[model samples]
Target chain A: MKVSFFPGCSLEGTAREYGESIEAVCKSLDIELQELSDWSCCGASSAHSTNEFLSVALPARNLSIAERKGQDLVTPCAACFSRFKAAEKALTCESKVDVGIPFQGKINILHMLEFLCREEFSEDIEKKIKRPLKNLKAVSYYGCLLVRPPRVTDTEHWEDPQALDILISRLGGESVFWPYKTECCGGSLVLTRVDIIHRLNGRLLDMAREAEADCIVTACPLCQANLDTRQEEIGDKEGVSYDIPIFYFTELMGLAFGNKGVRKWLGRHLVDPRPLLESKGLI
Target chain B: MELIGDKNFRDVVVDAVGEEIFTCYQCYKCSAGCPVSFAMDMLPHQVIRSVLFNQKERVLSSRTIWVCAACETCTTRCPNEIEIAKVMDVLRQIQQESGKQAKEPKVPIFHKAFLDSIKKTGRVHELTMIRNYTQKSGELREKLKTGEWKNDVRLGMKMFLRGKLKVMPPKCGGVKEVKKIFEQAKEHKKA
Candidate 1:
């Protein structure tokens, strides 16, 4: 249960709730999160989009540090998980990538969702749930990073991933089946093209609404922010109102575990999740 | 690396991406599955075709490469297993290096602003990054010129009130190492 934690950049600010809920839920599950000291950013979309070498090298620096620890490294951000895994894949597959650091590819880079789905943790999660989420229909949104390019993430059923849905089921919430679960939310275009993002996320929210999902559950910080914040504008422009709140998969786990810290963590969202949580009588 | 009839472009692509573009076979599956195709000037399949035909100018000038969100959905579903997202990245890097104005405009600005933030701080400071982006993006200036500029100050205020926007970035002990990685990576660029 002891794993090195890499709380990526967004977890510091925009996704603070995710970090808080992750820490709170892991404690409730008795999982020890050893902080990876002084980890750099995983280079997300920018590094790869600009310089291919930096994409591998920036993550290589972090992996070099984590590799020395010899423990499973888990990050809350799906983008970071993908970036770290990309570096590991390159280092393992190629011999010429010397980013001035020796990386042996000894550690397993795991997304927090992937970590939670571990058999030992999933088996024990049900026992710790003091209050099961009833009447909460959540559509698990994996976004793009966690499940695509299956060779890198090694995720089976990448097109229709069940990691978050299974966790939702264990938390006693109804995991609604939805096709837009793996759709891209245009996360990398957040600063560049808000117009494109609005349209793309509009499609996602529209599908979620049609799926009758009371709220969308996700693990990516950017997806949660984009889906939550821009939804109002998308509604105003499209004349189809959307009020669905976004939740980190861990936040729900913390709530189901009856962790008291989750009460504050729920308040950080742009589209307030508390209304739905309260109406469901789960808050 | 033959210099005849798209062979140079083909070799460059094969060097950066892989030879998968040669195997694409015009399936159009990648373009069909791409989520951001609505904003792209060229479809994914067409870009592959452009590359195969040595239409480097057309491929680089198009907004498709810059606008691609790198979602990798197209790459995943490619029957030929072409790494379409990586190809987009490769094309963008080439475009950036070409020193021409990006037709997609603000995306490259955002990318530069993001990387500079990372190079300076070992991580992105969102508010700072966005501030840098707005300052550098000429499209924003054009919006301002035409009085079409709609600022997100309200959104900023909302995020700030929600405690999502931090006024100051955290201290990162590994920032020096990050700069070193950037320095070493320059040698890695395929010249």
Candidate 2:
């Protein structure tokens, strides 16, 4: 399947492994990722927090670019997906805004997990799993964007999304049920309010342990950064050794696909997921 | 911003958002579902109530709107079908227009530095964005005062060692288009 890919800013910087792993897995599956040439930022939380018009217009610009491609647009970053959804809502709904761009909102936008979940890919996906992510108990965290605002995102099960869990099960891994699966991680507030991030992310880490999960898996770059990079600080502040690896869905897919670049991607993790994968004997 | 209505603050908000604000019957589901409500000075339900009562200044000055992560969990679970997150966004827009306040001051700085990075490079480079954020927020000095900057510096160095912090941004080909979008969107705000 060929699709327009928008590797938002995080993928190039902090989430480089996610970008690399997505490419590696897609190549193994014979799926072509035609990157949206010069796709700019989605305006994320910043634009909406300051200016609404700019927020919708920013993503509308990219949507316009992809609309011309006449292909379904896909982004791995949930933040970008949500931002594009916002633009789609504003440009196509009853309360449509004139974003000064020719955004028909005709292209169907999907997150990477959603793109992989298509029925046509499942048989091929099962055929591609060489490592069979056994002994990998994961909490498939959907975070905030992938499923929320039921009307805007049009997500059927917003409160209890099953997209990641479905993908994890198909990959030969066990997924744990947890209440904080869709909780907020104080995104972008990491630099502004570390205390808030500690409190919020600490709750998620503690809950993951309570659920007896091995690692927290997510598709959003901000959620992973907040959980992975800040795990140690939260552990120290709370006086407990909460050692957990936060994995991107793509990384685990690459691991299961037995793609060679999985290790290089895993090595970039702040929490270093190597020990977890090694302990599972899946590496 | 020249809201659609000028008679009352409630009308202004309803116009910016929708008529859903009137449908909110103080269910408190929004506040209950909010993950960060523990840190909010004004709860999500209370923010809506304040707006309904036309408490514009109080709603704008409170820390609840800024602390909100826009998770939309509240919006998803609202029994009244009110999109609370959109209301929060409108409140934030009005707050930005009314001039700066001291509640969660650093949050706006983060947004500014964030958008400025996108404006300059057509995408956000973490190192550059964070540098600009720290410079604007005086976060380093504040952390130095409390001796907590060590942790931040250590974390950044670790990210750098992992090669996650790139020294240069990618060559974005649509920077001019992005700038034009921003300019035209500003015009949209004006009209």
Superposition TM-score, candidate 2 onto the true structure: 0.97
Mark the 10 consecutive residues where model 1 chain A has the least summed lDDT: A92-101
Best by TM-score: 2
State how far residue B22 of model 2 sits from its true place (Å): 0.6
How many clashes in candidate 2?
A: 0
Task: Give each prediction's DockQ, rounded to 2 decimals.
Answer: 0.79, 0.80
Model 1 preserves the real interface contacts to a fraction of: 0.82
Q: Compare the candidates by DockQ and give the number of the best one.
A: 2
Question: Residue A219 deviation, candidate 2, in Å?
Answer: 1.0
lDDT of 2: 0.87
Clashes of each: 0, 0
Top-lDDT candidate index = 2
- The TM-score obtained by chain A of candidate 2 when compared with the true chain A: 0.98
**Candidate 1 displacement at residue B43 in angstroms:** 1.1
Model 1 lDDT tens row, B1-191: 32423447667777877777788899889989888898878899999998888887888889889888899999999988888888888888877866789897788888889888899999888878887898888665776787655547677778888889877976789999899878876766544
